[model samples]
Target: MENHFMKRSFLTLPLVIALTTSAAISQSLPPDDHQNVASLQSAADQGNSDAQLKLGIMYFNGQEVPQNEAKAAEWFQKSADQGDENAQKALKALFR
Candidate 1:
């Protein structure tokens, strides 16, 4: 019985380690993409130029938000109006 227990323990060790490692990795990753985009959108709506620029980039690249040049341009324009140089450049590029 003791030998059988030892064999079982050894067999379970790797499985235990793999599960622990997976949990840790998952915890370290960023939150859900939708949640992130929603938070960014909220901030942008509140007139945060940086958030607007980031949201614009996300929309432009379809990263979380749908790919919509119109939405991206709108967000970029909002940031540009607030004197965000990056957003200004992006807006110009989008229009060009």
Candidate 2:
């Protein structure tokens, strides 16, 4: 049980960091997803799972971008494919 708890914490740590980073950077992000989001876009395009997850949330919530379920799924799928635990959870939640 202790080991399981540790593993769960490890898995969730990235998610916590991603969410915190997203919130920290949100104010500086472009108001439009299509516009410049160089740091995030660069990392995501390079297949960074965390950035992919962030993009998924932005699209899903219309945080800084227009709400588009399709785009959200697309980003989440990309991260999930990379074995990001948070992204996998996000994809599941997005579908349901």
Please identify model 1 stretches exceeding 4 Å from their true place. 1-35
lDDT (10s digit) by residue, model 1, range 25-85:
5357776633376787899999999789777776766666688889988988999999987
Tens digits of lDDT, candidate 2, 1-96: 999878777775665565556656766766674434578778999998878888887887677779887987899899999998877876655454
List candidate 2 stretches off by more than 4 Å: 1-36
TM-score for each of the candidates: 0.64, 0.61
lDDT of 1 at 24: 54
For candidate 2, the lDDT comes to 0.75
Give the worst 10-residue stretch by lDDT in candidate 2: 29-38
